[model samples]
Target: MSDNASFPHGPRWFAQPGTARTWRCASAPRQVRDFHAALTGYSPTPLTELPSLATELRIGRVFVKDESCRLGLPAFKALGASWAVHRALAERAANGERRGRVTLVTATDGNHGRAVARMAHLLGQGAHVFVPRGVHRQAVAAIAAERAEVTEVPGNYDDAVRLAAEAAAGPDAVLVQDTAWPGYERIPGWIVEGYSTLCAEIDEQLAAAGVAEGPDLVSIPVGVGSLAQAVVTHYRSRPSGHAPALLSVEPDAAACVLRSLVLGRPVTVETGETTMAGLNCGTPSSIAWPYLRGGLDAAVAVRDADSARAAGDLAALGVASGPCGAASLAGLRAALSGPDAGERRTALGLGPSSVAVLLSTEGTAANPRTVTDE
Candidate 1:
């Protein structure tokens, strides 16, 4: 409420109470952390406190989980990519499939492709990455830098995902997609499980910082909702039965989750170009929808200009952030201000003493910049 007047057509807020049940993880939190630890250059990403920003926002504290560098990649996608690949490979081995070099296949707007390629390179396997036409060329090059074959498809990300699924049907190929359809859920589920490592780390970091249960609110950037599902599941399933008020942020042009939440079912939207390239997804993952639909406290769609400003704000605080990453801040500003903000805040149980965690999903300029009409 401090700087609401300066906000442009801001921070649309939509929220409903969560009604979903919890799930049991396939592997325990310690096991997932151990798996990540076994990887090269594995360590917990930084959870930075921004007291100045917290003061500006008039909150107890604002903590950011920096994922700029995860396992040599410049994004958190490596966690999901590596763990999914490992599980996929292990399943093949268990089924008595011949041991041979296998190619990893996936579609990405950017980061996920490079991550899968990195894992493939490490495993002495091949990688073929498919990208939508709107994806930045630098992103394609980064994926290619891992020696993965890069293919530019005809339409949006969903179209590229279709082609990737087809290519992965080859006997020597394994599809490691992050989003899910009907029969394509198992791999994506493992990806979500992999992302549990992030929330698990957040718990440890918050405990180390002396926040016993957790922050009152956690703002997460949503693409296809896998990571958001992971966050929702992690907090809701806590042994102490304490969960944070989960908020999801997305690009206005592709707010599938927000739209789906409003309609009480999954729905797809036509996506357009935006600077938040990593989150330019048109559809929500079907498997993730159930968890998200029942667990999210709020969902917000932000403009490119708003996200850019938030990124700059983070930069001034020495937190390098891209549009997708900084979107958490943009969404937070709207959720705590704008229309019905006071009522919404009360419903979410947020107050001056409430702490908030912003999940910064990427580093600065992870994708090429795009022009947008402010």
Candidate 2:
């Protein structure tokens, strides 16, 4: 982890200059959503506008894309995991592969494993999920409830990822990871493609609400950067002039994406302990690096206290959010109040007329007490 004493208890912002106005890849394929819509509980999540929050922040408008109840799961991971599983199976069938028993394997801090397990169960296949030490017990139990074999590793998320990759080396095992490495880009790419559903929903919902223009800013939490990459690609690929300035948020302890952007390449760092478990990743996904490099206008790293405060604030607004879910808002607050606020606000085009969308990526999956009606 970087020296926290330097960026203690606040936000550290980094601006990426010369970001491209267009995406390097094609638009998300419709078949991804087509596959998911046929499944049970396939509906768009909520795009809630919080006028009070907007007033408090002094922003033009504040929109929160809530993913708390996506696909009967507590988080948005189902969108990526389920879609990746379907694509993997479809690829097998395309090659005239024999229909044998298959098992999906991957590592997670919590939500992605549960999602993979659920998808595997739905597909009548087996799932083996690896979780790191200090993962919330509720999340592990949820994955086990799906009848997936759960293994607890002694180290952090990266260690579990290594073990899961080893387990997936078998012929009957398929790895459905959101992070990509050498020769492992295809599945992760499909996983990112799956997240397009959320972006598409946001577009339609905003249009339905009579908002002719898309948001001026989009804030997303980064783990391995897949979801952020999806958001960037979705807006940039739009035919309309709605390419919102992108903001990537990460834990101060594990700001690999920010560090990578600073170094002009991928750089791994040791992720220290963080309350936002879902965002504690030591490295950015190889597949997501290029898109993020080209699309993100700015990045910010926030402390655990920031996330906790944001969660409480959302709770006061009647939205249930875990720390990781509220991290984007935390980053937004940090960016607006930090020392570089003027430059960052100007660079991202944030102002009184600038509408911003913050993605609440999950619900209170682990700590039920974190959610409050007050």
Candidate 3:
């Protein structure tokens, strides 16, 4: 059933060859990582070793890139937002434009918008954030707390993106969307580039832990697939040719990336409400599609209960994570213990000695949304 039945409500897993593809980097990965390092209050987020969880999962080791806080934001979105905003402003300045202040506009389910607003606040610029209906009021208030203008669209996340795009017209505003379509790829690509810092930091942390080798697998949570794209591109493009098996996790109600990969081309879906609010995307990013198709080893969707349980499990282990952030754990469990798990594990070369890394992309306070599956 790898290629069949990719509905939004079903839990599914699909694997692919994940051939490597060439991409012309807008900026070198080192350059992007160093740029974040030079930022004020810049510090490498923790790569926590979860030996207890690893033992429970029957793996050699498990390391989670704990992204609860980065540059004063509660999610890894700040990495992309800061870099994309900086690139956009630098591009405008290169064009010799003398605008008093440029407003950054973007749409978000929650974390991305708040991160963008934080960047705009830092640069003393304006931010106009568009959120779809059903995003928690707390998330909206967080954006407003950054002194940004928050607008609620009446439809889904994609609709908010549309409104944000429309509002970003003219020289005084720049659309810093994380998803890319035709004629709007630059800023999104910059955002993808910005996410390389996470992978770079993981490498440094792993080396420090005396595990200088790459993990057998990495589970990444997908929201429009930009961060997963960054991870795939980073690993596949490595000179050492040590790209691990990359698995993307998403909510069952919003498994756009999973459904798209199942179809072999990007396809929009009827996204429903999910506890992983940050991942409630209906469509995959066009710019990220190629890299994901060519470099992602697999994609899976998990239920709200699973995400909540995963969040609780991580919290019990002293790792602070939200449902959206803990979706990686949920999906990793599904991939390794669900139907045909033995086949999947054997296929991925996973065993008792397999090492795995999960990207915990947010903290609990990042998106205070309730998760009661009705």
lDDT of all the models against the reference? 0.83, 0.85, 0.84
Residue-by-residue lDDT tens digits, candidate 1, 1-374? 11222122233456775343233323334577789988878888889999987887778989999887777667788888988999999999999997899999999999899889989998999999999987777777778888999999979999999999999998899999999999999999888888888988898999999897788899999999999988887877655556678889998878888878877889888888888989999899998898788778888888899899999898888787778999999998877766577777776678888899999988854322211100
Q: Model 3 off-target regions past 4 Å? A: 1-11, 18-28, 366-374
Poorly placed runs, candidate 1 (over 4 Å): 1-11, 18-30, 365-374
Position 227, candidate 3: lDDT: 96
**Pairs of residues clashing in candidate 1:** none
Candidate 1: residue 298 lDDT (0-100): 82
lDDT of 3 by residue, 1-374 (tens): 34244454443888875343233223335689889989998899889999988887788999998888778777899899989988889888899998678889999988899889888988989999999988888788888888999988889999999999999997789999999998999999999999999988888888898778778899999989999989887777766645578889988888888778777889888888887889999999999998888888788888899999999989888788988899999999988885588877765668898789999998876333312110
RMSDs, each prediction? 4.7, 3.3, 3.7
Against the true structure, candidate 3 has what lDDT?
0.84
Q: Model 2: per-residue lDDT, tens digit, 1-374? A: 21123453233677776455555556889887788888887888889999987886678889999888878788899999988998899898898777887999999998899899989998899999999987778778888988999999999888999999999998889999999999899999999999998988888998887676888889899999999889877977766566788999999988889888877898888888888999989889998998888888888898899999999999888787888989989988887874566776777877887788899999984434222210
Error of 3 at 83 (Å): 0.9
Candidate 3: lDDT of 347? 54
- True lDDT of residue 187, candidate 1: 93
Q: After superposition, how far is residue 230 of candidate 1 from its true place, in Å?
A: 0.6
